[model samples]
Target chain A: MHPAGSLIIFTVLSGLGFGLLAFLGAGVVLPLGWEAFVWFAAGYALAGGGLLASVFHLGHPERALLAFTQWRTSWLSREAVLAVAALGMMAPYAAGSVFFAQPLPVFGAIAAVLCLATVIATSMIYATIRAVPRWHHWTTPAVFLAAALAGGALLAGQLRLAGGLFAVLAVALALHWQAGDRRWRDAESTPGSATGLGRIGRVRLFERPHTGANYITREMVHVVGRRHSAKLRLIALVGGAVLPAMLLALMPASLLAAGAALGLHLVGILAARWLFFAEAEHVVGLYYGRAAA
Target chain B: MTDLPETTDKKLGLVIDLDICVGCHACVTSCKEWNSQGYGAPLADADAYGPAPEGAFLNRVHSFEVTSEDGPPQLVHFPRSCLHCEDAPCVTVCPTGASHKRAEDGIVLVEESMCIGCGLCAWACPYGAREMDPAEQVMKKCTLCVDRIYNENLPPEDREPSCVRACPTGARHFGDLGDASSAVSQLVAARDGFDLMPEQGTKPVNKYLPPRERDRATAAPALEPVGEAGGFLGWLDRALSRL
Candidate 1:
């Protein structure tokens, strides 16, 4: 795919946003404190609303509800179902925390699990597609989970943590960056090896079968150079990972400062997400008179 | 036992010969004529008189010239449409179960009513077969002329697919590929056939016979002798010579 910037931002931004909300809801529903309600609601609202915003990137957003209909086979459908499920669980969990008496820790734990389910569902949406070899792997879903959790940890550090949470989140961010980097590298190194071609060889398209660009070419033949990607990675590491970690670590735990730090982290994560799609090479790229690697 | 029972053993499919196909687009024309009037949604053409126009076609023959240092220039005529793979990704991706693979014939079909126009099926396809009808906002592809082939009202001999029937060179064939002993299968086996992008693992049931062996000796059009008196052109030449 051409890797629409809007979609990249949407998935990553919404992922972090919702991920934090789910995590906050988890903390609220737990016996953490009723004082955490505003933070939790704010976080959930940000992420949930962000996720909803991501739908705008789709060509046919009107049919979004039908995305859940194929739960029998589609991972996308599973993701849809889980999104609704998380929303359902969080509404009660949030309500119990706000209007009613303080809820028990179990409530937050349930909300946490529901939030995690949404993350899994989102990840599986890309991972399930067998056609895109770069995406159709175990690492894809793992990477998504890691990024979401990392975002959640960063949010938690920025919001509630008094001392060492920043350090922990920094370490988590570093780990995620490393893992994501390796996945992107692996995807690049793997040549456009189609099925039935057992022995890999350096193959180049000497001739293309068409004159004008076809739909497949337009959609799948996107190429991002190594030099550009390297620069983007640097930006992501600095802006998305290292800087956010430093800001969260150095800054005071006031709502304004913490919110700013969270915002910075969110920007970084979005950049990282965009690079993730950009760096990943599709096998179909080979058909478009380009080297997949 | 003579008049006991009549068995309906029809295994309908498409057989495209890559060699004889000149990519004249006659099949595309014939297909549009049959399908537009036959069934389902109209394949609309946009901007017919304007600078740019787009239209839907069940069958489109693409001409490609594949050249290499190892072999001579090969003009490959690729007629693209739905292959209706047994493991069609489009079918699996459809949310409403609108797209389905027939158990009997292995023909993948879409039920228009259930389709929500998500366009996910289009993304799943590697062949770029499924096109979203802008008018109806539903996915459309080659149905292999389903409405006509089995229509008992049509004459028995005329029941063949329009494309196959219209092909002057006998390049396109329609038959059941499921039966190993069937003509289509036999033809495929006799001639080592190939499918487009088989690496996709769609397991497309449709088979394409490679270009026929060109007899280098007899391939070129034979020319007449310099002076053939009885020939029409020769007589005209003699008259012109006298003048």
Candidate 2:
């Protein structure tokens, strides 16, 4: 699993953006006039910017609209549709509150749910990949949802709620990592099974198919960042979850404290997200003789 | 449209014999040669002659050593490509309807015109079968040489996959595996050909024939010591010694 830069940005930014939108729609923070405008603008900018970043990774960005058609079977397609729906639904509610000072509670509630659903859809894009045993677990969605909720609470200035959610996020992250580390071996997929040569005897790669790297090796057989994973995990826990949780709990509620907490949390989450892809072992690696034992 | 059909009309695929493959990469070369010009996009190479060359290939041959208690280690040349599964995760995972299994022949293909090249299909495949063409920036895979297999323009004898036609040892066999009476199905029955990664539950159409057991006693018979030379040779030897 290659920890693609665009995808990392997309997942982290959009998760935070949608989390904020969810809180706003749920009436967690009620701001009027220009203040409402600022909040809604930040939400749209982060969410929209993240969505835009995703397109950069596509080979044919012009045909991305076609991606919306296969929602019935494709999580990526579902994500595209859900993102659009969430943003579209939130638009009117945001406009009414910001410009007209009319807080449409019912519309806001619906938009909030949609926002959360979009995050779920985004998480499912990775979660549904059975080829990557690490991500195929139920804990993938759990980790993602917890992060979004906690990050959203932080952005919405709900320090009390954010502190609780961060604790939950820490637990989810730990659970996901613990389970994910054992997923490949638990699946019982070895090189012998991958090549259907187990019955004969022990199978070991005698020769690789090519001297140079191919797309599959580049995309799925990544192992370069794995050496630093333990250190990165510590960073993710401290910066993304533990410190943020502690800061919100002990410190007085202030704009500066909240901003500093959000910055640290984002840095931690970025590192965690990087690990999410870098540490994941795709079953395809077995064929290339690159999978972890 | 990404949803798979209930079933395909014909389960057309390949059955490769590991024992016969010499790891020559002839099928690999032929597949690339035909597919580069035949299909939607030419298989592109990045820095082909540069320090670190990379390219998109539809098929590749990997060699592995199989060691058993009964015999010494033996090398098996394994050729890998798309299995074109009955339950292809690649097709269902396509965000665009570009990746789909044909209901008529069960050949999984990418409709390149509709492809957004998001690469989720490649990620879903456990076999590492599909490759993203670097230059074209679209997913490339073994189409089973669909252009040649069904092409009326080609000679009737040439109407098969390029790899099958190019195999020097006749190790690659292409036919309908769904039909019990088909030659490939019969061969599979006789040789105990098995699917790769059955637990993935992709229900692959393709099969692989395991390498036959090798004769451990490969040493040549010891030459008998000639106690005395044959009549002509003995006479010649004695006369030479007298001289």
Quick one: best lDDT, which candidate?
2
Residue A114 in model 2: lDDT? 90
Worst 10 residues of 2 chain B by lDDT: B213-222
How high is the lDDT of residue A214 in model 2? 87
Error of 2 at A281 (Å): 1.1
**Tens digit per residue, CA lDDT, model 1, B69-171:** 4445555666767877766777776666667776656666777766666566766776667766656666777888788778899998778878888888889
Off by over 4 Å in 1: A28-37, A43-65, A104-107, A157-218, A221-228, A249-260, A275-293, B1-12, B32-38, B45-49, B55-60, B68-70, B213-243
What pairs collide in candidate 2?
none
TM-scores for every candidate against the unseen true structure:
0.76, 0.94
Give the range of the ten consecutive residues with the poorest summed lDDT in model 1 chain B: B1-10
Give the per-residue lDDT of model 2 (tens digit) for A125-233: 8898888999999999998899999999998889989999999999999999999988976887788888889899888888999988888988899989788999999
Model 1 TM-score?
A: 0.76
Q: Compared with the true structure, what per-residue lDDT tens digits does model 2 show for residues B19-62?
A: 89999999999998998898889988999889998899999999
Fnat: each model in turn:
0.17, 0.89
What would the TM-score be for candidate 2 when compared with the true structure? 0.94
Question: Candidate 2, what DockQ?
Answer: 0.73
